[model samples]
Target: MCLNKITLYLLLFCSCINESYSANISEDGSFQLNGYGMVAGDFQSEYNRPKNMTLHADPTGPNQDPRGKMGDLGNSFWHDYYTSLAVTKKWTGIGAPEQWADYTYQVVGYGDKALETAQNYGRFGGLNFLPDESNIWAGRRYLDERINVFAYNTKEVHIDSGIGYSSKNFDFAVGTAQIDWSSSGAPMAAEGSRRIFDLTYRLGLTEWGITYVKELDNPLGTGVQQATSFSAKYTMPNYLGLIKGQSSLQIQYGKGVIAQYLNTSRISVLSEKGDSSVRFTVDGSISQFEDFTVNPAFIYEYTKRDKSADRTTVIPDLAYSGGDMIYGYENETGIFGGVTVKQNLHHQNISMLYEFIVNNTRNKNGVAGANGNAYKISVGPALQLDVLPYIAPLASLTLTYAGGDREVTLLPKASEWRVGYRMEVWF
Candidate 1:
């Protein structure tokens, strides 16, 4: 709201009209206020039936196959509460520590209300000062704010804030911004704005970047109103030399209003006249390993729309009653791959988890759910407090596989199981 009233009148004129510039701010120069929260609950059963499901999952099962993920596509299941908040400032020795400032806020909701879903780093925050080795942030900054949508910020559109800069005289450069909205208070023009140009370099284990996203203003009869995107992120680290972690690759391409949120573009124009999308991802990690640690991920996505986009039966003198279920999708494709293993079990707090997944989906027009191939198997045990596992309480046992898709029909096509307990944490 007007940038929170101009940051509360510049913090009330810098603590009441600056008291000698407040000792140039430094008391060992470090401050942080961080937060993350999780509270989840779910119970379901259908196999020898009796558990009387509640709060979700296993409707026709395979976790209802792809509903734009968050445990769904992977079938891990979470029921509610995911949040993050942050506050920070830096300046040490009363001099330069690459001055910094931070403010971040996030919202997530599911059952029983936690702000009823106003997802992701909304009203994000930032402030940086360092005219040397990089740091000059002014408004809108994004790089997957407040994380978690199963990571990789679900691949781009930057998010949105506005007015930004990076390359405090270059150090390989880094500048970001994000804003996306369709609802959840003020922000119009269909609510999406992206303007970015990137340059990053680091080689020793590989690190590369190429980014360009330009989306802004749109909404007059829709046929297109600014849209373009390009992305490339590459990283490689120790794997074979000893497997100390890190592996990455991401590729993206979009057009016309960033092509339908790619999943949640949040809107701001372009629904037809050539919509498009392309995506690819590869995840990483393999941390040392003695007790165990390994991670892997892969994703691929493709989307296309413009087969005369937008429809609700296109009003034929209007007079329908569920008559047109909107069977239109133009095209969509997906593939997922996964592997996760962790085992420390003790002194490090506790952990024992294993997972395996495989997925495939396709649609050219399917009534809002299910397509094909799905398999996920998770085994779990976790207990860690505060630092690392964040909170605690977690139990897992999931097995899913429903490869029967004649356009989905009660996929009791075999394997399905879930042993649950919620309460996730990450800090």
Candidate 2:
């Protein structure tokens, strides 16, 4: 809610500029048009071994390869298209004209998808009742408070067709969405909808928020499904020539219907019950460590389930490669530590990350077994370049490698390597 002196100056300077593009103007010439379009795509390759499967007789099932059927395979170019339009006007009674009221509409598409596809359309709109003090809007959008500035926010909660209100010190939203066990595959209508709520406040140097999700009729009959997040962030000014620093702590707890997904193709068809999970994460960033920007993060997670809970429920987001491994839905706990560093080289940015993960499966009595203890290391490197100044021509490449020791009936030991490249042009 606070703007530094330089930002204030920039705002003041921009107010004096006149728009060169205007269409469908109102009688008072207050209406204007603006929009941007972008096309992007990426290609990737992965190599790994098949797990718990034999070319001869397979007990786990058919077509089950622990290392992957294609030990090495190339992914096709996945595409994305995005565009947005906005209209704004000044309300004399509401103070500043530019901040008075505005509306926005956006649409995005995937590879080979039709433009009119309802599933591809993303829309939002808002009416400012009191300039920046209060507003209301609805649509599918990300509305979570992101505390980590240096990394992609994997923790931001997403919602659909949600209404929200923002004031000087507080922000909140509520919405409903279909319950899906994973982000992939077609969702089933057999289950009831889930309701989402989020509220946050800013006070002095820290911001805090709580997010809750509830299931109306959880298929698992595990009572009302609930996941709650309590989080806080503290920001400090820069010192010793480094940019300002930020630290964040977040805790998440979930009970009842818990769904777990791994990779993109497979779905653990077994519906799990008596699922409960807890997770704590600490993330911090130092904008500059000498010539490199360093961001460090740590996570501790634990999940407990009934004897019948599938082992997959205990797995965390393991795409990063080096973090601890949680193989299945047993009672397990995991700890992860990682650091990401970015440095500017010539006109490009080079970034690298390294992570260490350790996890163990424990019984109801909290006794760990060697059969379940696992460890892993993950590494990733990436580079981005702006080859052309016009239309924001850009290209990037990333590589990730992960390997570790895991005790599983299937593929007790497995590793993965992936390389990907992306290209984009915008206007």
lDDT of each: 0.40, 0.39
Quote model 1's TM-score. Answer: 0.29
- Cα-based lDDT at residue 333, candidate 1: 69
TM-score per prediction, in order, is 0.29, 0.56
Write candidate 1's Cα lDDT for 197-314 as tens digits: 5544555545444444444533333332444545555667755345688776767666653322432223333234366778777777788878788777777877676666663221
Minimum summed lDDT over a 10-residue window in model 2 is located at: 1-10
Which RMSD values do the candidates have, in order? 20.7, 11.1
Candidate 2 root-mean-square deviation in Å: 11.1
Q: Which residue pairs come into collision in candidate 1?
A: 140-162, 142-176, 142-177, 159-178, 159-179, 160-178, 160-179, 161-178, 261-265
Model 2: how far residue 122 lies from native, Å? 12
Which stretches of model 1 miss by more than 4 angstroms? 1-67, 70-89, 92-155, 159-273, 276-329, 332-425
Model number with the top TM-score: 2
| Counted clashes in each candidate structure | 9, 19
lDDT of 2: 0.39
RMSD of 1: 20.7
